[model samples]
Target: MEVKLHDIGEGMTEAEINCFLVKPGEAVKADDPLVEVQTDKMTAEIPAPRAGIIKEFTVQPGDTVSVGSTLLILEVGEQAGVPVKIEKNLPKPAVAELQAERLQSFAAVKRKRVLASPFTRKIARENGITIENVAGTGPAGRILDEDIYKFMAAAQQKPKLPAQPAPKEPAKRNDKVTSTIPLRGRRKQIAKKMVHSLNTIPHCTHFEEIDVTELITFRNELKDQNQTISATAFFLKALSICLKEFPVFNAELDEEKEAIHLLKDHHIGIAVDTEEGLIVPVIQNIEKKSIRDIHKEMKQLTDKALENMLTVKEITGGTFTISNVGPLGGSFGATPIIQHPQTALVSFHKTKKMPVVTEDDQIVIRSMMNISMSFDHRVADGATAVRFTNRFAELIQNPKMLVLEMV
Candidate 1:
């Protein structure tokens, strides 16, 4: 029987196949991971549909499949021949499930059978407490992640606080303290992806500096006329124009397969680092939009990025990406890792004052920003990347191009 891909998250219509863990005719366990599907927003590992031999696999790596799409067929193993229907991972229940669980527990178990997940139960047992004694604070008293944190914090006797120090002797030496930050959520994912990228992809870095004093002056002039426009909005208007002539910057190389994939649209992801680590929300069909539209959408994307309201579609599946760490308060160009598969990423520090001269070689102050870009050596050469970056720098350095775009 063919196991079809189902809607794993709300509003998720499709997913791009990222990797295949099991090959056809491979035997697998009940919950063994089969393939990984990366939607625009997140990556999920599909588990075995049943403990079976994969009879036929329908999807390949990089296929974009919508919900309810056929994914694979399997021939059930003998012992599990009854057909082990693998239930897809589900989000914790909503209001209706909460109410029903509450009703069932109130009348049926009467709080005797503490509703804790398997791992939580293990923690409870290790702490010498029975599941029934945990007293869950989760909906319908279903123990949750936070509940575990609270329990863990309470179980062990914490170290006592030290008294304020008396006058220390001059001989006292400074002592070093070591701290271990716990890995959780996106930070954890970022760590994993970074390691994967650094290990798997053959990467090369390039640096360039462009004087953009003219661009700044032009942006200010435009803003004076159109008070609501933003410099970034104007710059992107110019970027769209450059991309029309050069498409290599808009492509990706599949490292494992050694082939370049062509992206159909210009959806540029601007990497925004928050307390939630790096989230790259995309601006879709950037070339087709005007400066006003780009300005509005950028504002919206930034807000969504801040509030964590961005959907998977909003965050993933872009061919090109630009990351600005300037807003984070840095003003120096820095190296950024290439988001694997995507051939390149453009990054820069906040704009800063630097020394420059006009074509006449007049000594002067210029508005300049350092440009840092990372590229996949397998996909794009340095010359092509430099040309792409220069086009962006040219537009930024000459802001009048923006006015022409709107006209």
Candidate 2:
């Protein structure tokens, strides 16, 4: 049987082979994982169709294969008829050693049954740690990346013998040191999307400063009442309201049809920076969800993004995108690029206390934040973008007003 690569995600044309889990001539049960493949968005494992023996691999690690391309060949049932040779008589010592080796191999196979994600297993492999030895604290006893780190930390605490000093060798004059990173996975996908967005969209960014003093005080009051909510959650709610008023910013431009399609469902994507790359996971139906619900889902999605466990459905179908770079401390401003096909993106910067003049001409300290809103110039003009942001700022500055807008 020919085991082929299939489209794992929405319109995924190709994927890079990461590694093979089973070896040639190894016996595998039905639905056992055969190989790991890295798509542009996430990593996935291809499983065997039925109980079979691996015959040969059609593609090696790091090979890029397209949908319907042959990944490997499996010999099932009668097709796996290779004879096994058995010795009738042998020395007792050799026979005993053979039995022991088989037992060890059986134990190794049992260890491979541990539950873990592909990315988690990748961390274990890179650290040269046997995953079975690390105790899992995750649900269903699944091994997590943190478990491997804890194991390594425990091993480091063990005392070691001091090494003997050796004569130093002279440095070579011709040697030059440098490092290189292969841009083939998510990094490559990000680069391609960035280039396409820049080429196809006429981006116009507008910058503004928001007085968040009242919002901070309101949030603290809520916390005192044991109703803690993130500022971004409030921001998303305000943005949803603004999008309802200015639908042009929450739209897509179809050049071929010469039409502007305004989206009603407000699926907002939050840009999360991870170890792999910048990933945006969408929170669906922000117009219908409350601030508390948005906060809970945002935290859950951000956790999944950092662990590289977000699904295709969780990352797609976004009408707008936002980046909260305040925690990263870029306080001044940034020209955030809009997600391709999406009309606008907003980035909130760090908030700081500054002297401000009140309406009564009295000077007081106020918490202020900077925001950069970028929109497609072909879809919406500068004046509209300004109005959209002004409404968002108004809602944020007086967070209690958001309660009236809520369902």
Candidate 3:
């Protein structure tokens, strides 16, 4: 019996061959891991094609394969002469037509009436529009798109509406043909959650700065004891300590039925800057773990993040996320976007030396960092968010606070 591979996702057949765990002539049991495929959406490990001996193979490593595109021809052993049925989850005929229409053209006339979003259709109807202008506000200029007709109409109605900006589609750039990369993985989830958060929960950003000269000196002193400890690790330790006092920063916005619910767990997602992109892996049980434990976990998370084995679950779920780009480069000051549901995201920028007055009223150099706090105004008040940063600032400068709570 010949075995064929079918797609697991809707028309998403091709996948990057991550690795082949088995070689030809290898006897395998049912459900044994065989070909590892990295799809656009996910990585799947295709199992054995039945209780069979691999007769021949087709594709090799790093190959993109399509649905029904056989990876290998498996000759089923007589013991189980019946080949495993490959399941192809193609969309139904009508559904396929609808999807094709959606993918091909944004909106088209159907049954003497154009099938479009209510907004776009309304805009056309109101203006006595004879022609449907396919304006591609969407990526790739292909408008399977959303038409902001009300916004357009409202702006058009108001001549005083400050030089109604022309459509942004015709801008020319360097000889490069620009293309939009779809938001995938963490970026996709982040975009979705951000829209949901900003749309549902009101957001207000607060900015502040922290004088960390004392913290710098103390961190250097600790570096003498343990060279591996980073300023970022030290900051995480400090933030954890301060969070214990500021319980409101630990609360989450409950969108359903509208209420703010307090969660006791402080799972901190420390934003590690990997060569590929920024990833925030959670340091679980932050309140339970000591500073040393947090440091070790940060290192592990950083390493895994760079290596790309951290998994999807590792990249998500946190009451708050701390982005420590301070050590990498760029001087203090950045307003980071709040990482949704949590109501806050803290950005760490580079600390620069700036002149400041001391207790004795003399000018002195202090290491200053701009703490950009993006918080949901609905959940945390401007005063509360600023106060949280103020507390975080104090905790860092007071190095004693970091180690004091460690024991």
Q: Give lDDT tens digits, candidate 1, residues 271-362.
A: 87654457788899998898789989999998767545566578777777788776665676777887765767777677778777768989
Q: What tens-digit string does per-residue lDDT give for candidate 3 at 1-407?
A: 44445675433545666555556655455565567665533345677656555657788866666677778776553433322333367557855665554333222211121223222332344444421354545444423223434444545742122112244455576645444564443344346556766686566777787888887787678778875567777777777776777777777867677778777888888876543345578887688876677888888877766545465455555787888777678675676766666867778888899999989999988888887877777766888777788888878878777666777
Which pairs of residues collide in candidate 2?
none
Q: Write down the lDDT of every candidate, Cα atoms only.
A: 0.66, 0.84, 0.62
The top-ranked prediction according to lDDT is 2
Which residue runs does candidate 3 get wrong by more than 4 Å? 1-190, 311-313
Best-matching candidate per TM-score = 2
- For residues 327-370, what per-residue lDDT tens digits would candidate 2 score against the true structure? 98988999999998999999999999999998999999999999
Cα-based TM-score, every candidate: 0.59, 0.84, 0.60
Who is ahead in lDDT, 2 or 3? 2
Error of 2 at 53 (Å): 2.7
